[model samples]
Target: MNELIPKETPSLPSLPETVLPALDRLVSALGIPRTVLASSEEIEYAWRDLPRELREIPAELRGELIARMCVAVSTGLFDGAMNYIWNAAVLHLRNKIRTFGLPVVAQIRQSDFEEKHLLELQDSKLLELCLKLNIVDEDGFFFLDQCRDVRNNFSAAHPTLGKVNDREFTTFLNRCVRYALADSSSPRGVDISSFISAVKGPRFNHNQSGIWVQRLNETHDAQRQMLITMAHGIYCDPNTPEQARLNSIDICNGLTNSFTASIRSELINNHTELVAKGHQDKHAASLQFFERLGLLGLLNESEQHHIFSRAVERLWTVHNGMNNFYNEPAFAERLLEVSLQGAIPETVHEEYVQTVACCRVGNGYGISNAAVKYYDQMIQNFSPREIATLIRSATNNNNPLGRRVLSGGSYRFHFRQVLNLIDPASVPNAVNGSYIQLMR
Candidate 1:
């Protein structure tokens, strides 16, 4: 039957009488079936597609493997040709990786990436390494990985499941060339060692910081996140130099707004762990680190309370010290800014209300003229509950805030002006008598 399986080799596409004469004689003597090879039609089809595909490869890449592949194609051995072409593509990929700097790969991976390790990597793993280092972009990785699968299932490199047609072979070869065999001139991985050194070394002026920021902009997300988290760690380290902290903050402020949710969660975890471990100095610096980035809202209420209470205590201490008038304005302004980040939490309610009252009523000498405006602004923003506390405390004899107002004439007048800042309706009914008395 002409349509029978294997189709009696002569019925398949014919090969030239002169071609493979010696091999044909040897196979005939050994009783080997010609059907074991691809048909002449398949070989012809492969040749038609081969030249166009091979030309796309860099001329330098088409050396021994390309030559062997041509031999295999002429002999109608598509499997062996697939093997040779894949080998060429893989060899090119490896060479490209070497050019991309293994030291930088080690840094991005956060592990050592020596030459031997690269050499010993299996094909799939080599592709994975390229993906992580961004040697192959997402679309490139997707297609190259498919080509690897085709090579494994249909190539001579392994026990192939079955044969592939010429069109399938060309498609596989095309993908390998397009994705893994491209020029390696573009990707430059971020070097972790020099990155850490630059961040910890000198302070960054505009152009200096801009250069490093540009470098980070070109890297992929994984390395971007790692570097940002590293910068946050450096900033929060209690033992870091002030200038290093400044540099780290500069780097983080540039990157934080673009942070993925994962990065934000990681930063929150680091800050919370410091608090849980009672690393007081790190916790304090971490607070400022969050504050400087305008991320105070990312912190929990308890952390916000601590920041508020501590800021108030510092301002109160400096307000009573010898250089009170000269030193108080900056601290007062910072406290006002921190308050605007979130609502005052209940944990620091008393101190928050009374501290502003104390600074407003002044000491035995006089109020800080430079600090008074910030205090007046804070007074105007106090909630009804805080207003109630402020009014009730002025009548309590044991309260330092009350004692200050009761001590002198100018104190009483400044306290009255502070009370006038509140809308009458915002004052609670229970504290109405105390409020009226204070305003008078």
Candidate 2:
């Protein structure tokens, strides 16, 4: 248990020394026995004994609940203490449900229960629903229900047909503090931005990283998802430092399977949205994510193939008819990266070759620098037939536009590199000798 009480008590205005005297007068006026009044020392002890987790409760409730518990214990008003315990439990449960979001809360409502009817739930039913949602475990639910029974039987809110002893009341109060106030449904101390910063920072050593991974494992699903989503953003940002990106990837790989699944879904969704919006620069992030997935060996063969194929198709869509391929360099580089990672399937090799071969130069200045980088990768991966098809497509007479784009100016360097890869005899007769000489 965390320390709820400070080691030393300062003079508190809410718990004044005069409070007992006023209570004594009230008890006297009611003709109650004076034996019920307890000493100041006992009140202080009760306050000191409160659990640390309870200190994190909302300030309004924490102050009232602590004061009331202290007064009840000091005055031997066990029945009243039980009532306070019940109130604290109810407040914590309600707050937890609200934090869970309305979608989950709606699942708890009765079919006919309207939004205004939220507060109509009885305490017992609320505990039951929380238990159903796994918000509270079975033992917690049982213990809270038992506390409710005690409150109903002896607390001041009821007729007090029975009485509870100080020991029983204290036990109930401690249980409420543990099960309700300390529930995991509450927001964790760590937030998404801070989590991202920590992961991307170089300060966290191996032991610290292990500790964070354990925390992620224990974190609630909603909060874990938020952390992953933020981490993905950092990982995808092109401006993110290289070391930070690598660190982020390491952290993400350490996440639980559930977290990984959420990341996968989020990436797919982002890709779909970017495609729909026709945002070219944003698509680079998705391609980067795919390359990372390949490099990390996180993706299975089928998933890798699917992602690569979709990426190629998207590239095809973007560059299909446009003369200037704004993303051609990035597209070609990502293809080579993915291919080098061994993620691209042999089945897609033909399509991959054709896509690069058919891609048009945006302008004289916008040569396919990525395609130049991709030359060695293509040589290593492409079959002879595929290589021949690529050369023919770039140099064939029927496709004068393709021939002009490949054989002209700076593009000749890439064309010569391609020629060097295949049999010299396989080269088309129409190839310019000047460009071929430049290859030497």
Candidate 3:
């Protein structure tokens, strides 16, 4: 019978001798039940796992609340320990936001943000603000939010929704420490208000602009994407001041090398939204935004056509002006560059093909030699639709570019070269007859 008796459950580890006794004396003197706190056995279980979390945090973060948490854990008051952890975490996040700057938060949130508001933010709102500021990343937000819920429900901050076991409390501690406490040092937020002022002010020269670009590089990826899109929106706003528009695009151009697919998708969505709402001025501005950023490939075919057609019209008008050769290359080259960004939209295939041929073939006098390569490169990539447009245009002798092809000499000779540049495979069966006529 004695041999069949159960053995005792071994103790894990212990805290200071006086820690739980002092708490017991205080609670007993206050006539409180000892059972209100967890058992020493439970405390031992929870405390064994605590050191790993405590060790991972820096010495500087082990402040008053952290010390209080240690005492709370030693006294078997897991609720109080978590409450202390949560308080410490909240203060750390607020300090981070303060260091990031209130004005910048005001700018991003589009509301009056001050120290008073920061102090007054409720816990849930505080978490959301941290998420928005990029002070807390997405995964951190998830875990921290769970911690906050646990702190409210199971910790001593409020009446218990349900009791948390030693294991549950330690798990909460790990999450709070790892996600919020341990990860606090990285991902500094940008002061977007001052940043916006700098961008909208006079202008940023290369050195001046490079400084802002460097500041962006120092921040988190999400915030960097946010600022990039913000710059795009400012550039696309119809009422934005001219210098500001120039400054906005200039800043974006610097960050162009680092653009991700996410950033491209965001810009495209904004452009598409404006177009859908028939916000013509902003929509047109957005197309120019993508064009200037060399991101036309992100735009849909319709938007690209809109961009190309406008570009072609502007250049064609310039090409027909006085000193056409000297005055035309810059605008003509811009048009050619825009076409190269993506496939020429079929909607403007006729005008697009004719404009390039006209610029390449020149008028009665001479061509802009600076623009010849741009025109030639654009001609060489003509799709079957575009090749057909160029050929079909030649059949209409009364049209401006068609008239140039029929006038013979260098004009007709240049047209023949343009036809030679087109891939015969690209010529559709429908336009093969016209293609043969032009080639001959």
Candidate 4:
């Protein structure tokens, strides 16, 4: 019976005399129950995990935020902690945006925020703008969204019917520290600025160049874009020294290689999603992505081969009965112009030739013409055996598509000439006579 007596909960440590008025005012203004204020023990427990940099947050708002968070956690007022985190995160993001210069701030406000009402945006809108500006990546944006949801649904600011828990509040608080406050350093932006200055000034020595390349390789996708854009600016500047321009070009090429590799990986990994979206959408997306790279002059011969090979594979495998091979013609033409002749893998080349042989008018608007043009451009690079194989493949059964491709078109004379050079014996006497007549 004695052991059955209930024990009283321990009281929280008292607030300092100086801070008591502020805490009382905050509770009154926020309209939260005084019981939400935490014990000193609870505040100490939560403080252990607080980021060091968070303590450096400016004195004005930081004190209020820290006090509220401690109270909220100690008193099981998770919603109050969430609200405080949201305010602090928004303030941090706004400060970061202002540091990016007026041009960037104006651009984000115009594009992502309302022009006249930009200042009126709340936390969620601010986070959305940060996301669009690449100030925050997707995962960071997601956590911020969760914080917003919890604040809106469970905090004292709203009329909540349910309560949040300690785990939820702590998770949101850690994310705020990690994604919002921690990002204030801007080291990546500084590195990009330094690299641009180096590239614009003079040619880098071997060691310097090696260091620059390594840094560029390690950057995140957003930073990679900034580096590529800066390189392009240097490459296009007429006053740039030849050595500097050449170095910029090399950097752009390497970055482009990284870009294309990631794009290829994505295509491979998301093939099912792309297929469900239909080939037209997938083709358009791929072409636009590669074309942007090409315009930057980052699409190298090897990358062209890679993209063309993938395009050919999709052409063969995916069956869109509408017969619209969207963007194939443009891609093939670009591949022809950029790809190093004779560098295509044997398997890819074989598939490409076969694809062209089976071509019809609607499969892609100008695909047949593009394929024929590529073959003509690359004919000289073909090995004698490859040329012979192509001639045999085209002429066997008088392949109508092949015949159409080779007979009296833009590449007709060139195809005939290559045929005569590689394997004259394979060219029938009638075909040779017609070629001679066409030449006349």
Q: RMSD in angstroms, all models?
A: 10.8, 14.8, 9.1, 16.7
Clashes of 3: 0
With a 3 Å backbone cut-off (N, CA, C), the pairs that clash in candidate 3 are none
Mind giving the per-residue lDDT tens digits that candidate 2 earns over 283-314? 56655665665542454465567657866776
TM-score of each: 0.62, 0.42, 0.71, 0.41
Better of 1 and 3 by TM-score: 3
| Candidate that scores best on lDDT | 3
Tens-digit lDDT track for model 3 on 1-440?
45753323334356888876877898799999877778777887888877777865666787899889887888788888989999998998898888777787787788999999999999889999888877887888998998988888888999988777789888888887776777547555678777888988987788988888888887767789998888988888888999999988888888888988888888888878897899999987888888988888888777777788889998889888888778887887798778767777778888888888998888878778888888888888888777777877888887889888888899988888778787888889998987887777
lDDT of each: 0.82, 0.61, 0.82, 0.56
Q: Give lDDT tens digits, candidate 1, residues 1-440.
A: 56743211112234456655655665688898866767667777887677777766666666898889877887778899889988988888788777767898886677788999889999999989888876788888888888889889989989989998888888888888788764535455578889899988988898888788877776767677788888888988878888899988887777766878888888899999998999988888898999888788899988888788889899878887888988989989998888877778789888888988898878878888988889999999999999999988888878988887777588888888888889999999999988877776
The residue-level lDDT of candidate 1 at 367 comes to 83
Error of 3 at 419 (Å): 5.3
Query: Order of candidates by TM-score, top first?
Result: 3, 1, 2, 4
- The global Cα lDDT (0 to 1) of model 3 is 0.82
lDDT of 4 at 283: 39
Would you list the clashing residue pairs of candidate 2?
A: 4-52, 324-362
How many clashes does the backbone of model 2 have? 2
